[model samples]
Target: MRMTISTHDHVLIIDDHELVGTSLMLSLRSEGLRADWRGNAGGEEGILADVRRLDPGLVLLDLDLGRDRDGRMLDGVHLVAPLIDAGWRVLVLSGSSDRVRIGGALADGALAWVPKNAPLPALLRSVRAAAQGRPVMAPERRQQLIDTYHEQTTARSELRARLDKLTQREREVLAELAQGHRAQAVAERFVVSLATVRTQIRAILVKLEVSSQLEAVALYRRASGR
Candidate 1:
């Protein structure tokens, strides 16, 4: 069964790639919804300009721009803040399957991240759901994301509680670990021996119950709710 979009809303698409954005624009308009296409939507100045002009009810943002071999310049990750700041409902439309990227987008305030190749019907359904002020993650992909999100968030909360048990030195070491600093760097920052930093890190990891520093930091960020 196909889900129908509410016909009265306006959706704005910002993609540097012409084919993908234009195709969606035409298809959506054919379904009796208002759609507009912008050549690109990144950078502070350009985004501000479009926000003023389009005043769209919803925005579909492609995460990639022309910066790599694949022509991806500004990351979609970078846009999340600005869009949220402008009070626009945004959906990330990207080809990237990196869960961290998707999670980061969600953590940064995007309503959902829909793959570029999702079925037109599903995309429209997501757009409509978002327009109606509902949070909509892709149904087929929701469970895995939900599980991972919960795990990361829970681990972070647990880490924060353990940090309360640590001394100020231990916390400084933990903060360094969360920032991806090496033991030697942490030692330098704290003016301690490298071995001391390593020991503190070991204690922190054990206390946090996380196997790796990356996971630890991910947990910490989730716990901070930032």
Candidate 2:
């Protein structure tokens, strides 16, 4: 059943993509709902301000907020809890298909998610449902996403613990290898003997529980979020 748009609560769209945000705002307005688009969203402060100023009942939040004027990257996962805390419902509208991030947003209290590429009508349906304080996601499906996020977090924590076991020199060698540098090049760069660099590589592999240099480099990149 299509729920009627309630008059008590407005809608706010916080997506750094200007076109998407504005289009959503305009479409919702045509549905006889009050809507606003805030493309910049600034950062945490900007988000807080928007919540306070608009006091929207539902927020369409993007998981990747892009960046601010200073080029600092902003992750929308961090904003979900705050918006929920401020008494607004959040429905994630993100381009990223990363289940971990989507689940992370849900774990942080987002009501549900709508992909950035989802049909506009479908997306708006979710927005309206959220605004009406109705469930936008099934309980089972939502729990599955949350489980995926928790599993990834556990794996990442284990990987970090292994990475922490590396000696300072081994970490340097692993970093050089990650940059596509040959062992010979790394040795020369560090003014160390080729044998010394090769030994460090072996130690890094052992500490990271990887058998090959390639695996070691891959693990380092994964842990470092590169």
Give the winner by lDDT: 2
**lDDT score, candidate 2, position 33:** 79
Clashes of each: 8, 0
Give TM-scores for every candidate, taking all chains together and pairing residue i with residue i.
0.57, 0.91
Q: What's the true lDDT of residue 169 in model 1?
A: 80
User: Over the stretch 1-226, how does candidate 2's per-residue lDDT look in tens digits?
Assistant: 4338865568888888888889888888878878888876568788777678765588888888888889898888888888888888889988988899999999998888888898988887888778877898898999899999999888888888999999888888888999999999999999999999988988887888889998988888877766
Give lDDT tens digits, candidate 1, residues 1-226: 4336666577888787889889999977886778888765455457657776655578888877545444446676777778777767788888877776677677677788888898988887877788878768755565566456667767766757866776788777767777778888888887989988778877777877778777767766666654
Clashing pairs in 2: none
Runs of candidate 1 with Cα error greater than 4 angstroms are: 1-8, 41-44, 68-72, 138-226
Model 2 local distance difference test score = 0.85
Q: What is the lDDT of residue 25 in candidate 1?
A: 94
> What local distance difference test score does each model get?
0.74, 0.85
